[model samples]
Target: MAGVGVKDLLSADDIDESDLFDVLSKAAAIADGKLPARTRPRMIGLFFEQESTRTRIGFDVAASRLRHHIVDISASPGSRLGKAQGEDLEDHIRTISEYCDLIVARTEHVATVEEIARLTHLPVVNGGNGIGEHPTQALVDLFTIERRLGDVRGLSVALSCDPTARHALSFMKLLALRPPRRFTLCLAPETKLSNVAAAAIDDLRRCGTIIDRVDNVEATLDHDVLSIQTQRASSIISGRIGEMDTAQKIEDEKFTLTAEKVLRNRSKTMIMNPLPRHSETDKSCDSLPNAAYFDQVRLSVPIRMAVLSRMLAGRRWAGRSPSRSQPGWPETSSPISSSLSRSVN
Candidate 1:
């Protein structure tokens, strides 16, 4: 139980295949309402430096459903992080770890998150660290793939986007552990795979997973799964690289995913996106059967729940066992008698 509390989900490499599968299985049960909800007073602290709609809301909702009070800390300009406050990153983490049961950190530097994990005693969840790794999002992606395809290891998966995006890089590393049979990366000439991404490719090859790169969309068309990420939007919007901001837009004719592309797959290919999508995916594909990007968002809640629950590994709280089907509980409604009356009729 002591070692089960994952301090940092930096890469897929952080979690072995068996552990990854177990967490995902539990997450699925929680999502489907098959498991009894836990009531724990454990407070989780959330720290986000970047703009996030899905990851932020998902953790908030998941923790609330599990009856955990959340303490939020942001890394915006007004916060202590921007002022170069009284303490360094490690000192702040060590200080905060004493106050909160767990820390969910989202920062611009992967090294900062790793340093925090190294220094803190409490569990640290990498919400997203720069272009480093986003293990939880990858978990949600794997969960969605499991639900739709029933298997992940034998499938052909394609990653399309800027290779430098940490999320994509992290995902490739994770895929290496599971070892997808045929893994293809679709990228532009300027977007060669980063050193981290290249190492992941090497790992994939060593594990007997076929790996390739193509600049053309048609080359990526054959894969059974597609994971499209738009993390570059944040980079471009911030104008980090000179004044260039319009690179986020993929030409409608070049990299767009429409209904026609969905129909082209010989076998129905599941489409995934980390969301906040740009011009890469057209609005028309939203209704397609193979479109699972929104499903990826929906899966985040249970995965967050699983993460929170795992953090409370050793502590024995007055939570109902996950085994019971009807862990009868009352909502914010009237007394049990009145609640039963509505159902009786």
Candidate 2:
């Protein structure tokens, strides 16, 4: 298996089928304790401009397990780089890049990560870029799906949530990049791919992903994987301030994932959620064998370990082979082309 073969991971489109497979294999190997430890002692900057539980903890634990020093930065009033202090984000990124071998950032704007990657020579991995993309989360997700199901190619995946969820969007783009031989994407009736994501959705269709707009949750549940992400229901009032508008309480039974729904297809279906979950999933369903959301969270460690290790494997400190020389962006004709191309320019 080769390295990720790129400097930065700004979107799911950054990785192709081969890279995806390599990363997944490496993740499994690392989890099994078969892979060698990273000899390099490097520093990783984990910077967050938004609140997170899974993405933040997963990366922190992954980097530590790989034996890298971590510099955790949060945009808070007590911190020097706090937005309230009127600190320039670019300056902060540039200063941090000078000290870290790699930078992983979660920001409320897509342009923030793009700008950081553009300004820094260090590899920049997007933790979650506002409503734009959550590439790393997507990687963990695909790794989990493939691990549990034997393969992602030709799998039946249903994404149920508000279409605006960045995780859902990034996962969709990932599926588009190396589409299955035969795939079915069952989307909720209220969930439609955003206009900005139209290009990627079209690419998936061209690559053999059959799109279906299912009107009922039960209809979507009869698949190999059911990914539910309804966190967008709680609107963010101020991301930096950690203020969120309370979500309107919904009594719509159809939208909820009760134990009954999980039992309906529990024998073969894998239930998933990139969660700070609201009412989309029922707690009663958590005990089911097919309820894989916890496994998804647990696997985030090894998956991210593979990602960080592969990205930094060739660093001078790593004492390994020289980094492969590849363009920052994929060829214009490739499906995995960088989304940062226009923004960086």
Among these predicted structures, which one has the highest TM-score? 2
lDDT of 2 by residue, 242-338 (tens): 4333453442466577788767655467889888776778888888887889988999999889888878875221211121122221111222122
Error of 1 at 337 (Å): 69
Model 1: per-residue Cα lDDT over 1-345, one tens digit each: 454424455455567666676688789899889654556578888887777799888998988888888887565455565454545665666667788887788876556666666787777788877656677888888888888887778899988776656567667767766888888777654454444556667778889987666655555667789887553633642347554346655653545677776677553778888887877877887888878999988888998888778656642122212211111110012211211121100
- TM match of model 1 to true structure: 0.81
- Which candidate number maximizes lDDT? 2
RMSD of each: 15.0, 7.8
Error of 1 at 27 (Å): 1.1
Q: Compared to the true structure, candidate 2 yields what TM-score?
A: 0.82
Kindly report which residue stretches of model 2 are placed more than 4 angstroms away from their true locations once superposed.
Answer: 1-6, 82-86, 181-192, 231-245, 264-267, 315-345
